[model samples]
Target: MSAPIQLRPDETFILNVGPQHPATHGVLRVKMQMDGEYIVKSETVLGYVHRMHEKMGENRTYAQFLPNLSRLDYLGALGYTHGHVLAIERAAGIEVPERAEYIRAITVELNRVASHLFWFGAFVMDLGGFSPLMYAIQDREHILDMLEAVTGARLTYCYYRFGGLYNDVDDNFIEAAKRFIPRMRKSLKKYDALVTGNIIFRKRLEGIAPVSAEMCRKYGATGPVARGSGINFDVRKNEPYSVYPEFDFDIPVYHECDSLARYRVRMDEMEQSLRIIEQGLEKLPDGPFMAEKKPKTIKLPVGDYYQAVETARGSFGIRIVSDGDKNAYRLKLRSPTYSNMHLFDEACEGMLIMDALAFMGSLDLVIPEIDR
Candidate 1:
């Protein structure tokens, strides 16, 4: 009555990549059934870093849970912070100061740049290039210094508040950011010359792991992974929030649908983030950083609320169901890497194990985000 989709492999062996290794990125495991070097099928082993982040949100006050957002996608912590803060502010009917919004945009973009720079070095290292990681880390430190000065965090930042920021940015922070931009521009050029143009790097990723636009849509992917496959969707531009509408930047989309295309999307995005940061600094307004009359205790009405933000990996969304309580009746977190990583099981099948690893690197996954 029905035919089998394909013949089963006569012989195959299961292999575990890691719960502790670089190939999976941050406590992730990949289970691959291999027929020689080719993968017969693959399954991603998640929950290695699960922290019950959503449940924590339901138990704590709206303000108390802000710090937990950073722990989800530590590399792009501010992006997750932005979403949660926006959700709480909207629910409680708070008005954020324009200056605070501008500052939020600037810091988040800087964080995005830092996240991409880390990905660039790490992804290349996965493919056997080590020199680039040192350069990338050195450049990334400059960003961390500036962010740490203002947000007081090297990583896992909890800088945003319900109505605004925890504190205002000083002139020194603005000056540091402005000076940092041109220097970063030079660094991006160097990265392109050293990594992007290298023949070996090109050969490794140029046509490896080609994920199509339709496949990206089917899998509900976003950020560079989807953009690499020719899908042009970004929450910042598609659905403008905060001060993003005032800034000018273009979404980087590549039709190549290969590992190289994903790599290029992130590289180009760092440049776009710099553009957003530069514009934000120029248009910096003089106003209070926090709402003068921020509610001392936020208690949302009985309803369901949702907010979305474009993180370094992809779109991170927060949903809350409240029954007129200080603590949410139910809280849900939608992390982009979760959706992006799910596609790996299907995409890696029938490909060489080495190539499958290359494809996984292309995803730019941060496993804690998925595990959450």
Candidate 2:
């Protein structure tokens, strides 16, 4: 008979992960308890980049706060803008015209594609492959050019209005988007060849960060994290906001529940977004872009309104508690990355430091979004 080994209860070591770690990709602090390189316990402390967005929204009128949403999630500014604007519209009972809605949907989907392209690059980069990042960004630049032409901005687009879009899509803008899609499709094959099939990347990412569907549900995980775990819930599909149902595209789902699965989901989703954009552009009607009487001064009735949109990372929800005043009484942004990051402790438990970075990359977290 072999004797059982006794271990001390106080045997634990702390490993600080960031407010500066490359894996974190932004300002974030994670205190991890380790048994050697494998994490045993972890706690993430955020707010390093907190700008008090909710509080800021309280003082700004609905239209005035549009630009601020772009600042919260800089990587996916359009998505943030969509969430904020849609929330206000829903609360104020503002109906955007069909043409404007189509434009909004197209732009939002373009932004979603751009965000995923950047993530595809960053995720591969985190896994120690730099080539894919550049390749992915190459495709992303085309969309940025198209967006800049219409929005007068590249990254932070203040182009969404209360009842509709800030401006209409011109002939040149439509032509440019039409020309770009086919080329973009061809380039995706190159991206796949560069990283997806690489033995090293596959080995590193496959079967890692196994987040179960039950775990995702318990933590309120949304977007790719939940979808990666075989959860079929998508705010775009489920809630059906902003002209999404008019387009035909399959919501990509993966049963692997690992980093690789999430990667595949995002890649496939980019294709689906392109399809939606094509359909939106085709079905787009001609009309006034913005509502003529959208009210320069906006006020909502005293009530609470919650709106959720499917962002590049996940579902972003804005909760507004209005007091029938120009300023919001209270505002809360439920960013998807914040919840998606919660599962790190469990997913990273037995992972090495390198594996931990890979897991973090797979979550596709935007630090400001998480910290905010």
Candidate 3:
């Protein structure tokens, strides 16, 4: 690892949180300059799990890179996959059918819920609440079952294709999603009582790590991180990709900007995602799942094209440069986690180490997403 941050001989000392601490979450190392329990400064050291996904994109054919999207953020794999597919489709001038678009949106929103649920459990566990992790996992398992019935993988899903989806979702998938919405609503009520109202939970989070709207802009943060700060920008609502424009859903925002506000934003977002899924199901059209006509050898036009989609974390964008080649001339992934993580060094200053770690958890980072 990089040498621990240097300071005066005895006044401040460096502590390495992880390249493998549970709280650091997924092979991350944070070198903190600590004056006893309080952190004077911190630097997040990344790249332990860098798989060079962007380099893989340049080496692989357009279709070959579809599967790599999942490895970046396994928890919210579909969102990344959706961005990749949409980028390629737009570059190649392929039109996705209405039914396929609805299916993509439904599945992606379900994946978003799953991601947030996982985060809820993990974050609670980090704060020493063990029981809620079990509850969160139990609820998330149902989502996995629903996704597995169609995608054939619980995590690291590679279901979305260039023009549409690899396969069409059936009535069983639709019915299960319909059933899941109400069941999840009940679970949300339980979480509100069990976790949100808990005095200890609030004490730990309520006034900690206050991220301002200006900080969000400076760091290019999006998703709940931005929403919690009262900057109303969601790629789905603001950019309007796929069939999301047809749905009626509100982007939840809280001006508190503390960890609790971030937590509340995610909890409220699960409800909004359910609303999107329900509307998407109701309006799902009857048509081919994939485009009837597509190029045998997929190639982008001689220009650059970009597409952005809102994931469970924040806005994810894919930029592709092409000279009419089957493979990308340059493929760049703009992951939200990388931008969100940028604020950690400045945000952690002057806070206790535990609070700083909790603040890190609130960002909902996926390490591979950043390492990529």
C-alpha lDDT of residue 37 in model 2:
72
List candidate 3 segments past 4 Å from native. 1-10
lDDT by residue (1-372, candidate 3, tens digit) is: 998876665698889999999997799999998998999988889999999899999999988998999999989999999999999888888998888899999999999999999999999998989998899999999999999989999998999887778898889988888999999999999999999999988888999999999999999999999999999999998889899899999999999999999999999999999999999988889888988888888988899999999999999999999988898999999999999999989988999888988898899988999998
Report every candidate's CA lDDT: 0.91, 0.88, 0.92
What's the lDDT of the predicted structure labeled candidate 3? 0.92
Top candidate when judged by lDDT against the true structure? 3
- Model 2, position 351, has a per-residue lDDT of 73
With candidate 1 superimposed using the best TM-score fit, by how many Å does residue 217's alpha carbon deviate from the native? 1.6
Instruction: Encode model 1's per-residue lDDT on 150-250: one tens digit a residue.
Output: 88899989999888898999889988898989999999999999989999888888888888788888889988899998989999999888989999999
Error of 2 at 89 (Å): 1.3
Report residue 42 deviation for candidate 1 (angstroms).
Answer: 0.4
Better of 1 and 2 by TM-score: 1
Where's the lowest-lDDT run of ten residues in candidate 3? 4-13
Q: What TM-score does structure 3 among the candidates reach?
A: 0.97
